[model samples]
Target: MTEDARWLSGLEEQARARLAAPVFEYVAQGARDGQTASRAVDTWAAVEFHPHVLRDVTDVGLETELLGSPVGVPWGVAPSTLQRAIHPDGELAMARATAQAGGVMVVSSNAGTPFSLIGETGVRWWLQAYLPADRTLAVPMLDRAVAAGASAVVLTVDTPVVGTKYPVGRVVWDVVDPALLRVNFDKGTDERPGADKALDLGPHDVDWLAEHTGLPVVVKGVLRPDDAVRCVQAGARAVWVSNHGGRQLDRAVSTAAVLREVIAAVGEQAQVYVDGGVRSGLDVVAALSLGADAVFLGRLPLYALTDGEPGVARMHREVGAQVVETMRLSGCRTLADVAALHAPSAPNHP
Candidate 1:
C-alpha cells in the first residue's frame, strides 16, 4: 500500500478483468506444462541482493548508455506482437508510450505498425526479427528495417518454431473475440505468403543475417553461453537473455538464471539484456547485478493498454520510480552503483 509498492501493485488483475479471455492469454502465456513460467519467477526467488548500507549515496541516476546511445533508464519494452489485441491503438500507442517513458521500443517483426511508420515515431527504435529459413525473405526484411531507420536489428534466435499457444488461439477464435490481426503480415494468398510461417517455419541460421545487414545486430532469446558467444562473434552488439516469455520452449531455464554465464561468455564485447517474468523494480536490479546491461518487459505494458496509452505510460513511470526507490534503499546511487551491487542472488528475492 506504500508509494513504493506501485510496481508490486495489481495491474495484471485489472487487465484480466478488462480484456477478452483470449487476448489475455496472448500476453499471459506459458508453454506446455507451464514449468518454465514458474521457474522464471523462481529464479528471482533464488537471487538475493546484498545491499550496502552506509555509503555517500546521494544522487541516483537510472540513466545508462546502450550500444553507445543514451537512454533514460537501463530498461525498455520487449518486442511483443499483437499489442492491439487489448487496445485498438496498437503499436501507435505503444510507441508513444515508449517515447513518453524515455525508453526504447524494439518493434516486433510481427508488428501492428508497418516498419516505415515505426521508423518515424521519433523514438529510438530497434527491429526485432524472427529470421526466416529462406535468406531471400529474411534479408529483405532486415534491409527494410534498416531502411526504416532501425538503429539496431535484433534476431530472435529462440523461436525456431512457434509453440502451441493452445487455449489462447482456440478460445480467442472460438470464444472471446478477434480484435487482433498481424496487419504487417499477409495471410497466405496465392501471391503473398503468411508472414507467420515465413518467420517461424524456418530453422535458424545466424550467418545469413550477420552477413546481409550492416546494422548493429543483436541476438535475442539467447540462454546458452555458447550461443551468446557465437552471436557476439557473428557481429551482434548485444545478447538478450530471454525465453520468449516462456512461450517458446517449456521447462527452459529462467532468463535471469543463465544471464551471468552468457555475460561471462560475451565478456565485454557484447552487452546483455533480459526479459521474461520481470515483475518488479528490484527484478531490474537483479538482472543488472547478474550481468545484464538492461531489462525488458513483456506483459506489464499490455495490461496498461487495456485501459489506455496513458494507463500503460503510468506503469512505465511507476516501474522507473520503484527502480529508483530500490536503488536508494539498497544504498546504490545510479545505474553504475546498481550494476556494481552484483549480489549473486536475484536482486533480493533470495
Candidate 2:
C-alpha cells in the first residue's frame, strides 16, 4: 500500500480505538445495505488511466481555481457535520489544517463551530446549506456566512429528509451533546415549523439563493446530466456531482460513474466538482482526467481529525505529496495536462 493509504488506515484504527462506538459508526456507516457507499471506493479504483511516458515531468503544478478563487491544490475538504463528536476542536481544527495546506473548505450548515471563528482561521471556505421548508429561515445563516467571509454557497439538494441508515450500536445524536451539532442556529430553530429540509426544492430555489445572497451558488448532490444542466441554467456557478457520500440514497450512482456525463452536460457553462470515494492522490488525478475541475474529500479528513489539528495537516501533506508523485509519474505538468490525458472519445474531450 502507498504510505498515505497505510497512514490513513492507521488513523482509522486509532479513531476506532479512541472514539465511542456510535460516534465512529456515525462517521463510518452509510445508508441501508450500504451498497452505494461500499461501491464508491472501488468504482474510483476501477477507472483506467493512459499516462504519457516521454513528456517532461520534473516541474508539475497543482494550483487551480474554484469559483474564480485560487487554491493551492486540486482537492479540498468536503463538508461533514457533527465534527466535535470526533474531536474537541471541530471545524476550527479543519479550517486551520486546510489553510495550512492551501486548500479550500466547505463548512457544513450544521457545523459545530461558529462561522466567524472558522473564517478567522484564514482558510478560504464556502458555506453548505439545506434550504429549510420555510426558505426564509435560511436567510440569517446565509447572511452570517457571507459576513463571516465565505467565498460561495453550496446548496445540497439531495436530502429532502435524512436517510435511514442501518441501525448502529448507538446513534450519534442520542449519545453526544446536542449543543455541538448546530451551534450556528438559534436555540429553537429545529422546533420551528419551517426548519425542516425543504421537500419542494426546484430550479427556482437556485435562482432565489443567488439573488438573495449575491454569492455564487453550487448545486450539490447532482448525479444526472439533466439535473446538472438545470442547475447551471438556473444561475449556479457550479454543479457538484455527489450522492451525499452514499448516506442519502443506498443505490445512487457513484460520483466517479457520473462525473464525465455531468461535465459534458454542463460543458463550460459552469465548473464541475465531485466528492464520493476520492481517497488518494491517484484518485484526484483520475477525476481530473475525467474532466472534473476539482475533487473533494468527505470522510477522509474527518478520520484524520481524530488526531486533532496536526493530524489533519499531516493528512493534507501526505495527500499533496502523493498528488505530486502521481503527476510526475503520469507525465503531467499542469491540471490542464491531466485533462489532456483523457481519451479522444471521452465525454470531456473537445
Candidate 3:
C-alpha cells in the first residue's frame, strides 16, 4: 500500500482498538448495506489527474478563503456529533488542533463541548444545525453560537428523519453515558417537542436561518443541481454537497459523483463545499478541480481524534503536506492553478 493509505489504515486500526465496539461502529458504519459509504472514497480515487510537467515546483501555495475569511488550507473539519464519546477531551481537543493547523472546525449542534470553550480555542469555526420542527427551539442555540463567534451557520438539510442502519442493533448512544451527548442543550430541552428535527425543511428555512443568525447560511446535504440553485435563490451563501457521510441515506449518490454538477449550477451564485469520503490530499485536489471552493473531512478527523489533540494536529499537517506535494508535482502553485488545470472546455464544432 502507498504510505498515505498505510498511515490512514493504521489510524483506523488504532481508533477501532481504543473505542468501544458500538462507538467505533457508530463512526465507521454507514446506513443499510453501506454501499454508498463504501463507494464514496472510491469515486474520488477514480478521478484521474493529467499532471503537467517541466514547470516550476519550488514553492506550492495552499492558502484559500472560505466565505470571505482566509484559511491556511482549502480543507476543514465537517461537523460530527458525539465527539466526546470518541475521547475525553472531545471537541475542545479538536478546536485546539484545528486552530494550530489553521483550518476551520464546524461544530455540531449536538456538540459535547460548550460553544464558549470551543471559541476560546481560537479556531475559526462554523456552527452546524438541524432545524427543529419548532424553529424557535433553535433560536437559543443559534444565539449561543453567534455569541461564541461562529462565522457561519451550516444547516444540514438531510435527515428529515434519521436513516435506519441495518442489523437494528444498539449503537454508540445506547452504550455511552447519554450526558456526553446532552452537554450542549439545557436540561430536558432536548427532549421537548420543539427540539425534534424538522420534517419539512424547505428553501425558506435557509433565509430564516440567515436572518436569525445574521451569519452566512451554508446549506449542507445537497446533491442535486436544481436543489443547489434553489438554496442559492433562498439566500444560502454556499451549498455543501454531501450524503451525511453515507449515514443518513444508504444508497444516495456520492458527493464526488455530483460535485461538478452542483458547482456548475451555482458556482457563480455562491461558494461550493463538499464532504463525505474525502480521506486524502489527492481527493481534496480532485474536488477543487471539479469547482469546489473547499473540501471538508468527516470521518478521517474523528478517527484521528481517537489519539486526542496531537493526533488531529498530525492529521492536518500530513494532509496539508500531501496537498502541497501533489500540487508541486502537478506543476501547480496555487488553488486557482489547480482549478484552471481542470477547467471545463467548449464543445467541438463538426
Candidate 4:
C-alpha cells in the first residue's frame, strides 16, 4: 500500500490501543448519543461537489491567508487539551508537523508547553482560549500566548461548562486520564491578569484584548447569528463557528449549516471559519463552499498522535495530501476557486 493509505488506517487502530482508556474516550466521545458528533461527518457527506470540465489542472495552489497571515492550506490543527498524553512531544509534535505541512496550528490556552516554548517558524500560530471566569488566570495565559508569538487569538465561547461524550456503549470521559485532560496551568503566576474581564464578553473585555495585544481576535464556538454580529461589533476580526466538536453541547447546529449565517452577519467585514466533524478533504470542501475562510481539525490530529509524535506528523502529511487531491479533483485551482465553487446541498438529511 502507499505510505499515506497505510499510515491513515493504521493510525486508527494504533491510536485505539496506545491511548489510555480515559484519554481515548474523552477525545473520542461526543455529547449525548453523540448524534451531533456523528452529524458533523454526515453533514459534510451531504454536500456534493460539481467539478468544472475545462479548467487547467496544472499548478493548482491551496495557499491562503487566515487573518492576513499566509498559510500553506486552509486546513489546520485545532487546539485540544494536553498533548503529552498522546505523545512525549505533545503540542510540540503537532506544532512541528504544522510547520512541516505548511498549515496553521491553533494552540490551546491550556497547552502543556507554554506557547513561548513552541517555536514559531514556517507555520503560523493562533492562540485558542477559554474565557475563564477568573481574569487573573486568563490574562496571563493570553499574555503568554502573545509572548509566544501568536498571530491571532481565538476565544472559545461555547465551553461555559465542559462536554460529556458517550459513544457506543461507552461513557468516553470515564476512560481518559484526568491528568492529561487539564492542559491549562495552575493560577498565580506573572503572565497578565484580565481573564475575569472575559467572564461575560462585552465591549470592554473584547476591546481590551484587541487594543492591548495587537493580535487579530477571532471568536470561536459562536453558533447564533446575533452572537456572530455581536462578535464583529465587539471587534472580532473573524468568527469560528463551532459547537466545540459537539463536545460541549449536543443540540448545537452542525458546523456546516451555520457557516452562511455567520458569514452573512460578518458580511465581508470579517472572515468566518468552522470546526467539528471536519474529517476529510471533502469535508474541508463542504465548509469552504459554504463560505468558511478555513476549518480546524481538533480530534483527527490528536487521534494520530495516539501512536506518538511521528504518528501526528504522518496524519498531517496524509491529510494535507488528501486535501490537495480533493482540491485538484474538484476542479478548483486555488483557495479562492474553492470559495467560488458552489453545489446544492443534498435534498435529504443523511
Candidate 5:
C-alpha cells in the first residue's frame, strides 16, 4: 500500500478486520457511552491552524527532546495493555519499529512479554507503571526496569481502579495464550494485587518515586490543572495529560481541551505530554501549538501492531511526513515554530 494509505485510519480498518472481535473492541472501544473517546478525535477538528506563508518552509525539523532524551519524532507510543492479544510479536515488534524510527516506546506494565526482551531491541523506551497498593510489588519492577535500561519511568495514575470495559470484560480468556500475558512477575507467592484492586496511590507516592529512582518520573493521566500542578510540585519530571484513552471514565473532558489548561498550570516546571485521539501528524502540530511538549498515540500503535514492525514503521513515517508537511504549510520549521502557532481564539470544539 502507498504511504498515504497506511495512515492511522486505514491501518485501523485493517486491524479491525484482522483482530478478533473482542480483541478489536478492547483495543478500540472506550468506557460507557464512549463519548470521551470520540471527543478525543472529533474535538481536534475544531482547532484551525492559521498557516503563515513565504517562510523558509523547505526543511521542517521534527526532531525534539522529551525528558532530555533525543527523539526523531515529536510523538511516541502511549502505553497499551495486553498487546499480545492484538498480535503475537506484541511489544517486541513495536519496539523494533520505534528503534528503527528513533521514536520512544512507553512499554506498559501490562505488556505480555518481559521488559528485558523488549529492552534488548535497544529502542528508547520508558517503562509505564500501574502502581499497586503494595510498594513491595511495584518497587522491584521499577528497579528491574532500571537494570533493563529503561530511560524513564511513566507512572500511570488515572487507573486507581480498573474501569469497566464491557467488551474486554466479555473476552474469553480461555482461548488466549498464557504466554501472551507473561509479564515479569514472581510465579509463586509473588502476587500482583495491583492488577485487580485499586492502587490507592497518591501525590506522596510521586514524591517517593522521585526520591527512589535515578530515572525521571513522568506522571501520566492527569486531566485537571490542579492535579497537574500537584504532580509537578511533587517532583514529577513530566506530567502526561491523558484520559486513559477514554478507558477509565466516560463523559470525561477531552485531552484536546484539558491540555491547554494543564500546560498553563505547570508548563514551565515540567514537560507536559498528552495522548488520546491522536491520529495524524497535523493533530500533533495542533497539540504542540496548544502547549503540549509532545503527543502520544494509544490506539494507532496497537492497530499498527496487527501488521507487525513494518506497519508500525509506516505509521511513524506517515505521521512524520504529515508533521513536516503541516509545518511547511503552516510556516513552522521547528517545534518552537509550531508552539508559536497557538491561537488563543482557536475554538475548543465544534
Candidate 6:
C-alpha cells in the first residue's frame, strides 16, 4: 500500500520492507525477548469501550491541553531516536507534518538534525533530553533549543545504561551511523557518544533541570506510581508514563497496566501523559478515559516516515479521526465526557 492508502498497517509493512534490516530491527524491536513490546501492544488491544447509544452524538471533538499547551487532538508524537535512519528528511519531516496536523512533536535528544533546525520549521515542538555524565555538556544544547523556541524539556530518566537487544542477542550499537547522532551535541569534538548511549540520570536530576531551565520539564520513562509522585514533588511539569516503549527493559509492565495508578498519583499535581504500543484511536480514548492528559505515539510515526511528511500527516488524521469516531460511538461529546463515563481499573505494575 502507498501513502495514499492512509493505513498504519501499510506504513509498518512499507517501512519494514524498505528500511535496511538492522535499522528496521533496531527501531521495531524491544529489549531482550521483545515480550514487553509485545505486551504493550497486546494490552492496548484488550481495552473494551462501553458505547452509549441513546445520546445524540452529532459532534465529537478531541482537543485538549498538555502542560498548558493547546493541542488540537488528544495525542502527539513521542520522541524517537535516529529519524534519519528511517527517512532522508528525518526529524525535519516529522516536525513539519506534526505542525500541519496541529500536534506536538517531542524532538529526540538523539535527533539526526540539530534541535534549532527542527525548531526552524516553526512546528510546535519540545526537546527530549538525556542528562549527560557532565551536566555542563547539556547546557549549551538546552539554551540553544530555548532560544530557538522549543516549548518544553522532556527529561528521560529510565535509561542509566543501554539495555540488551535480544533480536541481535547483544547490546546492538551502530544501528544508525554515529555521525548523524552527533550533529546536535559536541558539534566540533570527537567525544560525543552515539544515539544509543545510555544516560546516567535519576529523579533528583529533575530538581537540577527545573532549577536550570526556564521552560516546563516533563519526566519521561516513569512506570511506578511512587516514582510518578516523586516526579511531581521534584517539580516536574508533567509525568510521561512509559517503559521506554518497552525498549529499555524486558519483563517491564506495559504502560497500559500501570497508567491508571500513575495518573491517580500525579494527575492532579501535574499533567499525566503516556505512550507505548498506542496504535489506534480507541487506544487513545482508553488512555484518556483513564485520566491521561494526552497520549504520545512512537513506532507508527517512524513507519509513516517511510512515506515522508504526507504519510505522517495521514497517520495524524487517521488517528484523530479514530478518536472522534470512537468518541461519537461511545456517546461522548468531549474528552471530559469520556473520562467521566469510565472508571479505570487498577492494574498490577512491576
Off by over 4 Å in 1: 1-8, 173-181, 185-207, 344-350
Candidate 4 on 1-350: residue-level lDDT in tens?
A: 13655566465566678877666766777887777877887888787676665777677787888888777878898888767777777888888878887888998876777576675543578888766555556666677777778898887777766666545544444544545533445554324454342446565556767876898888888898898898889998998898888787887789888788878888988988898887766688778887889888888888887666577677776776766777778777887777766764355767
Ranking by TM-score: 2, 3, 5, 6, 1, 4
lDDT of 6 by residue, 1-350 (tens): 22343476566788889988778888888888888988887788777766666877888777788878788887889998878878889998999999888899998877788877888898889989887776777877777788878889999888888778766543225555776675766664336543343355666778777778788899999999999898889889999999988898999999988888998887578998999998877788988887788999999999988888888888988887788878888889988888854654365699
List the lowest-lDDT window of 10 residues for candidate 3: 1-10
Residue-level lDDT of model 3, residues 1-350, one tens digit each, is 13464576477788889989889999988998999899998998887776777988887888888898999989999999889999899999999999998899999998888999999999999999988999988888889999999999999999899888874467676788877764666677878887788988998899899888899999999999999999999999999999999998889999988989999899688999999888888888988877799999999999999989998988888788778878888888889888865644465689
Error of 6 at 70 (Å): 1.1
Kindly give the stretch of ten consecutive residues in candidate 2 with the minimal lDDT sum: 341-350
User: What are the TM-scores, per candidate, against the unseen true structure?
Assistant: 0.88, 0.96, 0.95, 0.87, 0.93, 0.91
lDDT of 2: 0.89
User: Against the true structure, candidate 4 has what lDDT?
Assistant: 0.75
TM-score of 1: 0.88
Most accurate candidate by TM-score: 2
lDDT over C-alpha atoms for residue 218 of model 4: 86
| Predicted structure 5, TM vs. truth | 0.93
